[model samples]
Target: MRLRRRTFLQGTAAATAAGLYAPAVLAQAKFKVAGIHASPVENAWNSRLHGAMQEAAAEGKIDYVFSEGVSGTDYGRAMRDYCEQGVDLVVGEAYAVESEAREIAGQYPDVGFLMGSSSGPAGENFGTFGTWNHEAAYLAGMLAAPMSQSGVFGAVGAIPIPEVNMLINGFRAGVTRVRPDAKHLIGFIGTFFDPPKAREAGLAQIDAGADILFGERIGTADAAKERGIKAIGSLIDYTPRYPETVFANAMWYFSPLLMAAVADKQAGTPTGRDYTPYCLMKEGGNDIEFAPDMVPEDAIGPMEEVRAAIKAGTFEVPVDMSEPT
Candidate 1:
């Protein structure tokens, strides 16, 4: 009888150890996270946002509500919809609906608001964050300058905003570092999702002696591929689609950053600041990736050297975007 009782107690103990009877088990339920994008998932930036959400979900059960391709009036409505649904966190890119989001956040003070933006939030209930994407852009420019046979580079930008301008300036800096005389031809597409317009601008730059291109919009890389020029991709790597044409890509990892914010808010230490979370080689925020199949084997060694130097603080690439064009 004692042995039987011991066995039963051991079983109970094992179950308790496995959290089968913990009251907090039910209390620690999965939270819902909603992401509202300024553009569709077909674009790299939005796709990365979705990817981050998925990654967070895999770690813990997270229900994701995505409102993709939303802008202006629709964006505000979408925020309201997420709040009405009683989601724990509403994550969105605030570049398009900054003011509208701020107004909506004012109404739903309980809901946590996190934005991927260059601008900051006006209230304590909201927080804004963006990656220091300029570092990756500069690295991409470094790759392009040496590989460009035409001695010219091109950038297809979405808008003239500071975010886009910084990337253009970073790319120019990278090229200038290696090839100081290299000329950069830039085009602003005005809209982030306009693929045809972005393509046209890319082609025009190519015609103007830009043999190497950095693509920002949805179809900019496609334009570079069609023109038989090498392209550096932004936000996410597109080398899988155009192995030969895409030389390198600047990748963004937004999942960990967003999850950190959500966890902080849940812990009651919410940061009410509009800050650019620039990821460098040390922080693992942003990094450059080369096409495994297309990039020349000999170039990899030197690139790794530069990457390591940057990470080690020995090689500081000039990041000043205010330099005169």
Candidate 2:
């Protein structure tokens, strides 16, 4: 009876240890994040979010899954499915399904929702952010001003949405800062992922004597490359793809914002806050990149002055969301 009692005690202790170990292991499981893209992952805007999530996952920060080519009409459904799957956070563009997305967030109050939106946050978890790359776009335009041989710059945008307008306006504002008489020809393709339409609009602008094309959309570089003129790229670097055609790029980095959201989730204090400030230059959200050999030597100094001022919080890039006519 003594030996049996000792054996039973040892067995009970081992089972208790096993139970505790299992719980500890489960507690260390990575957070699951899901992204739903309105366009392909390769698209300009989605790529930023996709790349950020990829980087985070690679660094063992979170377990990330994404579904691309989700349309506006299907956005709410995607959100619901992901929420039902018990994802910790959902990230995507919510400009189209703002109302529906907010309603879904209300249903899943435990899960955090962060999206690219023009409006404010909703409830406790529906956070919103902007594309706030206007500062970088301004620098891109400054670089393009000297390259414009015809004194005419062309900007091709996905839509006349507030953020889109703000970005284009920033670029034009930078250009006119240098060349006061510079004329701009602008067009909106009415869709976000239609590169062919963007290219067509760019071609029209080029035909109208637009010497430097500001490609807020992807295919504008094709027009610039074909026309043998300089162009400015948005969201991603097109210089590698277009060689000498794309001289500068207005880049938006989403990693800082993602990490912030992850931190909030880990702290269990996630809130429906506007994360737009995380998209600013000082916050490592956006910046400009240019091929040193492509940009004129004279344009570098002024652009750097503005860049420095932006980082130093002295010079402010105006956010003009009014429709750019």
Candidate 3:
């Protein structure tokens, strides 16, 4: 239930030791798979993608390769490299370089490409998927709303894109769910990897009366801990690092769905569909977890109640992001 720091070398070593780095299997496998990312391998979001790949490769003789630290000018080259490598399935999150990826995908007809982007599947062999993380963020906001002493919650985000906007909007909705008059102080750091900027934004929000903070990227929790405010983590749990300050976290499980798609592709299914997979309460894709060290025992019941409502279709979390008049 907490974020564990891992180095890219460590992850690569583990994968290699587990037979994932086998070049023979990769070269002659019935289906070769590759993952590319704009974020570094050490990042929590990218780590989850790595974890998913490791899990999916467990049952089959699939060849697995990865490209990371890819962005802007380098994205096309990376995509082309995978295509030229004769990889059967290529998966990645193209945040800033979506257009570049689309262009590259257009050039590779035999290769199946899946990207986590705000854009469409576009090309014949390309597909797109994004996290329906707003639902989980809203739940985290609801939990933070009552816990805040200042009656103001803060959200530190990356890039202000639709992906990030939904999360911020969801947090705001959750806060309003519990405290109708709650005020949110939001900040955008423009880049996903800049933990220092995220930390600064969090600090600014804390200084502006925000007693509960939402950390969309890596460093916001450090700022929250320093300021003695409760922090809600995104994408992964961070309670292990900031046990006292982190109240809860929202987790996105991307592997199961990706593997399911891989199975479909292996079975000769068509690859042109725009598959937007979601992790709702029923699907077990998204989660709101409380820090064992911080959250009170009595709060679990209400949280489960809300979760059940979401699962049973009784409670719907609104995801619209239009500003209020």
Per-residue alpha-carbon lDDT of candidate 3 for residues 88-162, written as tens digits (9 for 90 to 100): 888887667877777787888877877777877776777788776777887887777778777988888887767
**Per-residue accuracy of model 2 over 1-325 as CA lDDT, tens digit each:** 4669889999999998885565334335878889999888888788899999999999988888889999888889999988777788999988788888899999999899888887899888988898889999999998888888899999999879888899999999999999999999999998877888989999999999999999999999899888898899988888899997998999999998988887887798765998999989999999998998988899999999999999999999999999998
Local distance difference test values of all predictions, in order? 0.76, 0.89, 0.77
TM-score of every model versus the real structure: 0.83, 0.89, 0.85
**After TM-score superposition, what is the CA distance of residue 84 in candidate 1 from its true location, in Å?**
3.3
lDDT of 1 by residue, 48-91 (tens): 77898988788775767687878676888889977776777888
**In candidate 2, which residue pairs clash?**
none
lDDT of 1 at 239: 88
The per-residue C-alpha lDDT of model 1 at residue 129 equals 79
Best by TM-score: 2
Lowest lDDT sum, 10 consecutive residues, model 2, at 19-28
| Window of ten residues with lowest summed lDDT in model 3 | 20-29
Query: Could you tell me the lDDT of residue 243 within candidate 3?
Result: 87
